[model samples]
Each structure stands twice: as structure tokens, then as C-alpha cells.
Target: MERRFEPPVDGRGAQSVSVPTRFGLATREADGDWRDYMEMLEGPPVKLRTSVVEEHPKTILTFNTSPDIGFDRSINAYRGCEHGCIYCFARPSHAYHDLSPGLDFETRLFAKPNAAQLLRATLAKAKYTPRPIAMGTNTDPYQPIESRYRITRSVLEVCLEARHPVTITTKSDRVLADLDLLTELAEHSLVAVAVSVTTFDPKLSGKLEPRAAAPAKRLAALGKLVEAGVPAHCSVAPVIPAITDEFMEEIVERAAALGVGSCGWIPLRLPHEVAPLFREWLSVHFPERGDKVMSIVRSIRGGRDNDPDFFTRMKPSGVWADLFRARFRLACKRAGLEKPNFELDCSQFRRPNVGGQLRLL
Candidate 1:
């Protein structure tokens, strides 16, 4: 195996690991090139700057038939997540573009600037059926770049105009920017937002999801959403065993205190290239217990770095799994929280106008 390349990109989850693309393709590696030399000429190491390449596609909706997934369709406005979560299952997706799922996945990104228009076109079809369109399903729609691109807000506007039902899953407080749209949708029970809180420790969260909103900010976003009458769900996602599991109770308690309607947890999932990258991350950040962390992970993963089977993939087994379930159940009970309800009303959906068409009031 070729050794993974380490890059000096500040504010990244995997500080020194970039697992090469598994797909057989020509990939660029840092070869003490100009960027590396810039470190010597400059005071500190050269940082990897974020770049975006636009893609124009006929359709913006993606359909999946997996039994466990809740929704049938989703929209991914961005290809790679800038959050650079070390354990993101979606990291492998960048390999298809001949990019490393490590640093490349965070710095080199693809944006669908025309996604809102494409989504409008799809919803305007005469035979179009209304179902909850999911955003942030693959790559988060409200990552840092969203403030400038505003693609997510544009999509929300289209949904609001069509009276379409939509669900947003994000890890950024930037979702608060569209509170006006979400507030209106909630009035009709057509929208739900799930904010994923990984950990409450700021330092740990910074290391885990580098560019995502801070834990406090995410919790505050949840509070604001619930206060605005928008259906809010606090997703204690990818609870890292031995690292973040300790905060499960605190997170649930805080969510309940904030008047959050629902809450849930998803165990850590290391899929494909993410496993190696995460192992490297563990070695760097938690050298003392890296072995122990992987041991617990493997125990729950059926003696592997990951579990990829359907049904069982999302539902991890083993004693560790049982312990986690019981702990989360107790946490929710103590916090007066319930399993999140993502179902929203789709009956109010009206076909959006296409091209230059206008609707009569």
C-alpha cells in the first residue's frame, strides 16, 4: 500500500492524513512542490485553500431504494463537505472524482450552482409527486460556503413558493439564515430540520468536525429553530465510542431544556476510505488510546473496521451496541425526549412555475 500523504491544512479534521483515492486513477500528491516550499519561505506551513468547481446537471434529485433510509429523494448541492469530518461515510464519494478523500475532499469541492433551478424544474413536472425532499443528505447544504453561495436558501425559496415539503439535515448554525422560510413551512407542517450535534466539548468537536458549527452554536441553532415554531430534531450523530459517548446524556438534557421536540443518536460509522483516514486521525489525536478506540469499534463492527451490510449496517450489534442503546434510551427518558419524527405533510405541495411561467393569485 502506498503511504498516505500528509498535508498542512489548518482547521481540518484529519490534520496529517489523506488516504489516496481507492479508485484506480491518476491522483495528485504533494511532492515538495511550490506549496510545500512556501512553508520555508513563509513563517508557517502553507494552508490548503478551499476551491469550488461548478457542475451543471439536468436533474438535482437523487433517488435511493435502501430499506433503512427514510426518504426516497435528496438533493446534494455540494459534492465534498468542507467540514472535513474524519468519520464521514460520504468521504469516499470524492474518490470518484480522482481526489483523495482526505484533504482533497475538504479543500477541493464541487458545487451545483444551478441546483435550485433544476429542482424547480423537476417539481414543476405535471406528473411530479410530492414527497419530503431531503437536503444535506450527502454533503451538508449549510457548510461554510453556503453563506456566499446561498444555493441552499435558494432551494428553500423554491420549496416555499411551491408549498413543497422538505427536510434539512445539517451540522451548521447557518441554517438559521433561512428561518423565515422554515417558519412559514412549519406553519403548514411541511418542514423539519435535524441539526447533528457530535460532541459538546469545543476542543474535541473542533478536532472531529473542523469546519462545522461549534457545539454551542449548533445547540443554539436548535433552540432558535424550536422557538420559531420550526420542527427541530437534535441528532446526536456518529457518537464516537470512548471519545464522545460520555456527552450523550448532557446533549440530550440540554436539548430537552431548550424545548427541542425530538432527539436521536447514530453510532459511529467508518465506511470505505474513511476507516484508514479515521485510524490515522486516532493515532494523531488520541495516541494513548488509539488501540483501545479501534478495539471497541471493531467489537461493535463485527470484528471489522466497519460494517457495510444493509439493515445491519445502521443497526450495529454486539454488547457495545446494546450498551449504547440502553444508555441512549435512559438519556432520552431522563431528558423527557422522544425519538424524532421526520414525517411532514406533503399534501400542500403545489407545482412550481417553470421558465417564465407565472401563477395567478
Candidate 2:
């Protein structure tokens, strides 16, 4: 049997604590010595810290024609997320940088400082057609580093200046920091925000998404967005069976109570390296139900670790699927949550005054 890597665990009665798991590292550091195994057993005395590298790309807007997803274009201010959600599907993209899809996906990050400028140039193109530009499509735009870099905020400023419609999907309450911009966009029907709430249990949330905002904070953020007249939607995303599924109803009820008119859930998706990393997470965090969790996951994922097919991937089948579907349907109905009709106003978009393209009606 291969030796398992153990992450640091904090003392329960400790005043302050930080636990970082090595479940999924985008790339492993090259071994300089055979004593690495000895070092592992002894454990490091210090906590792991995050490192960022700035990337300057010619283009900032990315486009895809995936039929299942709602948006066709998106902007990712950062290349890697620090949230450390073991189930994140975007982890595989790190391999392009000679990185693995595990812990490296969270700790070693890339930021595009020129994102706002590139976005402005892209929008100034005469041939550019306006559609809702989705933010937070790959990694959380409001991740911890956003406060320092403010790249996402810069991108939004460009959107506001261009009158370009934009949508945000985030797990951080930091979106509230741009309430002024968001409020103005909402007034013009140019923005909509969706906040993903995984589970209401803080302990489980810490174990699953160690760096994400607390569940309560996410709900409060959603409430604040709605109260500020921003079109907000709550998603009980990646509802892990026998794990996070238990909190679906409660999450929905809370969202509904917060004046959130729209909410839904997504089943767990274990694409690429995410599957192994999540399994490792389960073995370390919930060894008792690790097998059970995978069992239910496979059952709903067409009897495999994941269903990669387009339509079927998002829409699971069989009795277990039906049960989750029914439960979510009833929960939404009971909570008076209805599907939100958030059609961003693309007609209001105007080319930004850049690249020799002056603002023209």
C-alpha cells in the first residue's frame, strides 16, 4: 500500500487555527532528497503559504460553445483559485503549467493584471457583439487575493463604463464590496449575481472548502445583494450525496427567507483529477462514509466516477437522481423559490472608447 500523506490538524481548543490539506496539488515539487518520507512523518513546523505569479496575456475574454452552460463568453482574472475546494473541476487546467491538479491548484496561483485593459480593448473592437460576460466561471473572482489585486473590480469598472452586461458567480461576500458598481448595473438591468452555498455546516465546510467564505456569510451576502436591488441567485452547488445533500433543504429555506427568489442545486462532478483528490479528501475527513459517498456518486453519475457526456452529465439519472430531483423540486416549491428570469440588457452595450473606437451610439 502507498503511504498516505497527512495534513496538519489543529488543536480543537486552540484560539486560532489553520489546516491545509495536500489532497490535490497541481504539481509536486521535484524531490532533492530521499529523506522526504522522513520529513513527512515528522511534519513541517510551519503552515503552508500561497504564492502568486503575474501573467500578461494578449486577450482576457475566453469563449466556449458548450451547450450545457449558460454563457458563451467569460473572463477569468486569475488562473488558479485559493479556495482549495477538493471537488473543483477546473483543477485539471493547471497541468498546462507543468503542475498537477491537486494542492498546487490552490497554493500556486496566477493573476492577470492586464485583464481590465484587455477587456477594454476587446470590447472596443468594431465587430465585438455584446453578450453577458460571465465572471467567476472558472475560479472565484472574489478569492482572497482579489482584495489586493482588485483585478475583478477593474474588469467590472470597464464593464460599467462600456455599459456591457455582466454576470457573477462567486462564493465570497467580497462581491458586496462592489455594491456601488453592482447597484448601478442592476439599475440598468446589466448585472446578475449567483452565490454558491455548498453546505450550512461550518465544520464540514471547513473540511471541504477550507478557504471559502463561511456558509452563513455567503447567505448574508446573498441577502445583501437582493436587498440592494441586485438580481441574486443562490446555488446549493455540488450537493455531495450522504454528505452535503442533508443540508440542501435547509440551505434553500434560508435563501428563500432572505428574499432570494431563485435557488437550485448541482450534483457532485468528479471530472479529471478532482475525482482522486475528492476521494483522498473523503478518506482523510470522513473515512467512515467515504465508500458510501462514492457509491452514491457513481450511481447518479451513470455508474461511473463521472458522466462526461454533455446533457447526461448535468442531468443525472436512476432512482437516486429522481430522489434528489424530487427533493430539490419540493424544497424550492415549499420555500416559494422560483426560477429567476435574469435576461441582461445587451442592447445597452456600447463599445468602450479605446483602440481608436470612440463611444458611438
**Best of the candidates, lDDT:** 1
Give each model's whole-structure lDDT. 0.84, 0.81
Clashing pairs in 2: 24-102, 24-103, 25-102, 25-103, 25-104, 26-99, 26-100, 26-102, 26-104, 27-100
For residues 309-340, what per-residue lDDT tens digits would candidate 1 score against the true structure? 98888888899999999999999999888787
Best by TM-score, which number?
A: 1
Reference-based TM-score of each model: 0.93, 0.88
Indicate the residue-level lDDT of 27 in model 2.
27
Task: Give the residue spans of candidate 1 off by over 4 A.
Answer: 1-10, 25-27, 30-46, 356-358
Candidate 2, after superposition: displacement of residue 299 in Å?
0.5
Residue-level error in angstroms, candidate 1, position 248 = 0.4
